[model samples]
Target: MEDENNLAVLICGAGAAGLTLAIDLARRGVPFRLIEKMDSPFPGSRGKGMQPRTQEVFEDLGIIDRVVAAGGTYPRMREYQSDGTHTEKDIAERDDPTPAEPYHIALMIPQFLTEELMRERLAELGHRVEFGYELVGFEQDEQSVTSRLIGPAGEEFVQSRYLIGADGGRSFVRGALGVNFPGKTLGVRAMVADAALTGLDREVWHQFNNGNMERMLSICPLAGTDLFQIQAVIPLEGEVDLSDEGIMGMIRERCARHDVKVQSVTWASAYSMNARLADRYRIGRVLLVGDAAHIHPPTGGQGLNTSVQDAYNLGWKLAAVLGGAPDHLLDSYESERRPVAEAMLGLAAGLLDAAKRGEMRRGRELRQLDIGYTESPLTLNRPGRWGPLLAGDRAPDAPLRGAAGSFRRLFDLFTGSHWTLVGFEAERNITSGRKGLHIHRVGPGCELQDMAGHFRNAYGLTPGEWVLVRPDGYVAAMVTPDETSILQMFFSEVGLTDADGLRH
Candidate 1:
């Protein structure tokens, strides 16, 4: 028998993906244990670019203020020539914020600091990561999973209703489950380290590349910190060193400037370019996420962002299912996230190839704003006509005037861990009618008023049109208000019931 308030989920890794999932679960009152094999948090600057979509997610997680305070926009790249001259160019075109797209640019925050903020939020929700604890083994039946964990205490056992593996590319959980991770190694190896440097401008990302593209090195200044992240390509066949001398040696050999010196190395690692996708995201009561489910090159900065998204997509589904939703709801996790991983892998690979050819150009392609679930089984589009945004697309944010003469944004309504229903030009009582649904009727006397027509232009909705935004911010169903039964059917299909405990 399942206890009413005991641990229900076991997360195998305590990285960004695992931490994001844990925070969401904590907000939903889902009991879970987050375990990390490492003795402490990751202390590197890997995956430093927080894309716009991920920033939006950070906002919903209530860490936006901290993130924005701890990060800064990407700096311009200054390329050094073989003749000791340098040419400066913007890394990417800058975009001003719009009413619909609030986070218009990528923010640079070190991966470790990002994880720190997330852990802080999780702690406020009354849980902490069990560091130095390793998942030694686990087994599952139809009901629960029995896991063996080893730490300073020697051995401990836990029984959870589900097991999630977010344990990087070489996941022990995936290996034990015998899931096939299929892909090719790009035969390119790279080394990265965080260190303090001298004779380098902190205002720009410094790079050096030969005409033949045989070598490339970049030292980018990390935001909200004094350390710079050093990155360089290495021979695929040789054993590359990760010491301070090795990194400084590469910089001296590749760069035309001889005055630059590495003062100290904080953390370092050498990684080969391997692109792989798991054959399945789910098997029995076990599931995969983050680098465990898919691993790829970090050229596009999609790896970490995609991992956090996987957690976001899974968190609410897990909560709903545990709260009495259907088992099929859990299936949607794989259906929605696996394809996203596949696509992201391909995109990252393409970007890696471009960087290899010395043709890397940063643009909106890596932003991930266009990622959607148009093909998801959980999506329902029953409108007689389409709109600027589709049913499966991300719901855009727009400013609104509240009935109490106050102002708010659509994202303000979407800031919590709950599903939201928006009725355009509908009755005022529609917002107050639902309890858990968190309905917002956008019209006169309602909380959301489109005074500037921003919402109208963004959603392309007519009067009485209804849109059901999922807890994860994807549009689930869209239909006319009169077609309430269709909306009811869509909810039932997606394993959600109305506030009255009825379909409609």
Candidate 2:
């Protein structure tokens, strides 16, 4: 007999994607169960780079302080050539933080540390990941999904309104759905590990290559830790010895440096590069996120960041749908994120090829700040509205001065699970009470003043214009004072009524 337990959402896998969705739903008071097959948290330094856009997501999730505190900036690269000459240079171009974009550079934090930080935040929100619980099988109907999960206790059946597959690249959820994951293997293989080593400066990423990219070995110091991540290319056909002693021998043989010695390895794994994307993101009431939906090469450091953002985008829609919004809201998840995954797959593959040719240079594209959903179905654009930032672009942060002389940021106003409306020189009548919406007015005689012109400079708002930001920090719509009816219709379509805010 199947034990009956019903939930709003059943999240499979406890990695970045799963934890992110869990945290989001927990904060929204949406009932969810996050389950993972592993008995403990991940302990590897893979996916160590956090992009700037992901930092913005973390800020809104209220964990940016902890994430920033636990991470450090990327270090310069020191390349040793075959002629015994070495040179040091930056791995990527660094940018100065501005009022609109505070996190202008990628942060260096191990994937394990990032997951631990998010798990802590999730616990504080009164929820915890159910470890050792594996999703064995599942079936979906029009109303709900019945999932068979096996834990330490035994098998139990769970009924949930929806099921999300945030499992890794080889996701069982995706496999059960039989969704076509189509892509080619890039024929690149390497051994990656975290080890304590001496005779290396932690200030730079050490690369020892004898004028051959295929024979290169890199030892990068993991930020905020005493360990170094060692990566060495291995033959594609041969079996790699993943033991600590073997990894140490490989490093020693490749570098040929008598001074450097590996003390011990905390974790080690063999990695093969592949660029694949799921043919479909959703099948009925079940959906996929992160590596389950798309897998990328580690060249560009986009996988984890993209995965986290996938959960960020899907969380609000799931909450809204469960709260009585149109079920079609769920469809927007695939439409918005799949194309991004496709693009990122291409980018990562290109970077991998560039690295093979010894021509790789991390740039702004890897920072992921330019990602947006301007072409998404949910984005509303007024024909004559003119600005660099449009509907579906990320809402920029700016300094604000309150009427009582208190300083704040636009992000501060957008810190919760509610839509935000920023009206510039807009009529006061439009700012009237709206359910699940926060209104802020700027311009003459308004409560908040853009003292430094940061808001105006970032948004380029004309007088009497307004920007409606979605729960995920993207602009849902941009309108003029004359387009009030359009705004009302949008709210109505999104299940927000004048009488009931979000209909919870």
Q: Please, what are the lDDT tens digits per residue for candidate 2 over residues 381-443?
A: 977677779898889999999989999999999999999999987667474577678888987
Which run of 10 residues does model 1 get worst, by summed lDDT? 427-436
lDDT (C-alpha) at residue 493 in model 1: 57
Give the Å shift of residue 473 in candidate 1: 0.7
Q: Supply every candidate's count of residue pairs whose N, Cα or C atoms clash at under 3 angstroms.
A: 0, 1
lDDT (0-100) at residue 258 of candidate 1?
72
- Top model number, lDDT: 2
Candidate 1 structure quality by residue, lDDT tens digits, 1-504 = 124237788999999999999999999998888999999999998989999999999999989889989988889998878777889988776889999898888899999999999999998998899899999899999999999989878998889989999999999999999999999998778888999989888999988983334578889999989999998888777788777787778888787567888889999999898999999999988999999999989787899999999999999988877776777788889999998889888888887888877777778877888889988888877646676988789999999989888999998888898788888897633332443477778987666689999988998888888788988988887777566766666665555665676544
TM-score of each: 0.96, 0.97
As a TM-score, model 1 comes out at 0.96
Give the clashing pairs for model 2: 435-501
